[model samples]
Target: MELFNQIFVDPFVTMYELPDLLLQTLWEGFVSGTLYSLIALGFVLIFKASSVFNFAQGIMVVFAALTLVGLHELGVPAYLALLLTLGVMYLLAFSVERLVLRHMVNQPDIILFMTTIGLTFILIGAGELVFGGEPKAMITEELGLPTGSSDWDVFGGIVIFQHIDIAAAVIAFLLILGLAIFFNKTRIGRALRAVADDHQAALSVGISLNQIWVIVWFAAGIVALATGIMWAAKSDVSFALQVVALKALPVLVLGGFTSIPGAIVGGLIIGFSEKLFDLYWGVPILGGGTESWFAFIVALLFLLYRPEGLFGEKHIERI
Candidate 1:
């Protein structure tokens, strides 16, 4: 009975007693979920266009951040560094499409996956050589992102909101909205969908597989840069940050590998549930530190019940 009370009753009691805390927790979760969705969005973009899992995406985030910071450290202006970083990403996309993906066209999925794994190592080595292995602070102020916090008094208590977190949320939302419009309303976007459906057919239709690959990869790079900046602002920029990027795996699984909106919804679910569980039950009963594995467990349950994900299309093929 005591365990049951601790498991279920106490959490609700705490929530009832502290609505402000609940709101605060929800806000933090929203911020986290939005960033996770951003990272997962990179994955979705690449996979949708090229059918490659792009395992290097995590490292790409770190690399993009490192490049921006490194350029700034070398005396480039922040905005200039950002533009240069974007140019670098575009070069990477073009090189990848021309050198690696073009040669690997029509190859087995495993081969493409393995190629991305190799790319991850190359980026890691390159990043280390270029930026060193030390963690770097984000140029948040230089980038003009908001700093400090605001307090909201509600339910007879205070809830603190970080300005940077608010910025992250808003930027993420706008990025998602823009991408949705681009995907649904642009000529290249239709070409991307066509290539996603069938590469051979798309090529037959003159969709330019090479151009699509470069565009999607470059788009993924842009997402990586944004994710890296936001995440580094919250913490520090380092190769270690790539591990956190793995959290997007669960986000992708929950949201659906190919659905943009599903990624957003899935990220929020994981973010909210992880924070809530850690605060209410994990720390109290499980001795804390549940956030690390919480999302994956939730993702596993989703996999078991709804492999197609919330917005993912169910595929039926004759066996």
Candidate 2:
């Protein structure tokens, strides 16, 4: 009974007693979730259009940030470096389509997946070669991102909000909204959907697979850049950041492979649950570190009960 009380009852009691702390935790979770959704969005874009899991997306995020910082280190202006990075991402997209994906058309899904893993290694090696194996600071001030914090007084305590965290949340929300509009309201968006549904059928209807692949990959690249920037702002830019990006795997599993909204909802769920669990039940009972694996545990539960995910379509096979 004491263990049960400590496991469940005490956490709720804490929440009731420390409302301010609860709010702070929720806000932090929201910010983290927004970033996770951005990363998952990159995954969803490529998977929806190409039906191939892009395992390199995480490294792509690191690479994009490294490129931006590398250019700035060479004395390029901040905004100009940003533009150059976009151009670099575009070149990457074009080169990938022309060189790798174009040749692998109609290949088995496993082959395509392995190709992305290979791409991950190539990016890591190239990034180390070009940028060296050291962490770099993000140019937050140069990029016009906010700094410092504000405190909100409530429940006889204060909740502190970092200006950068607020900026990150706002920027992520805008990017998500813009992408949602672009995908839902554009002609290319319709074509991409058609291609996602059936490549051969889309080809018969005059959609160019090559063109769609380039566009989706490019879009994913843009997302990667944004994610890289936000995450780098929170910490130093390094190849190890890719491991953080791997957290998106659980996000994808919770959200569904092809769903944009599911990505958002699932990210928030993981974010809030992990933070709360780590602070409340985890530290008290399990000696902390729950945030690292909490999301995966939730993903495992989802896989067991609802493998299709919250928004994924269930394919009924007559076997």
lDDT of 2 by residue, 176-261 (tens): 88888888889998898898889999999999999999998999999999999999999989998898788888899999998889
Query: Which lDDT values do the candidates have, in the order given?
Result: 0.93, 0.92
Cα shift from native, residue 126, model 1 (Å):
0.3
Model 1, 122: alpha-carbon shift in Å?
A: 0.3
The TM-score values for the models, in the order shown, are 0.99, 0.98
TM-score of 1: 0.99
Tens digits of per-residue lDDT for model 1 on 1-319? 9889989799999999999999999999999999999999999999999878889999999999999999999999999999999999999999999989999988999999999999999999999998999999999999999999999999999999999999999999999888878987899999999998999899998899999999999999999999999999999999998987898899988889899999899989988999999999998899999999989999999999999888887899999
Which regions in candidate 1 have their CA more than 4 angstroms from the true location?
Answer: none
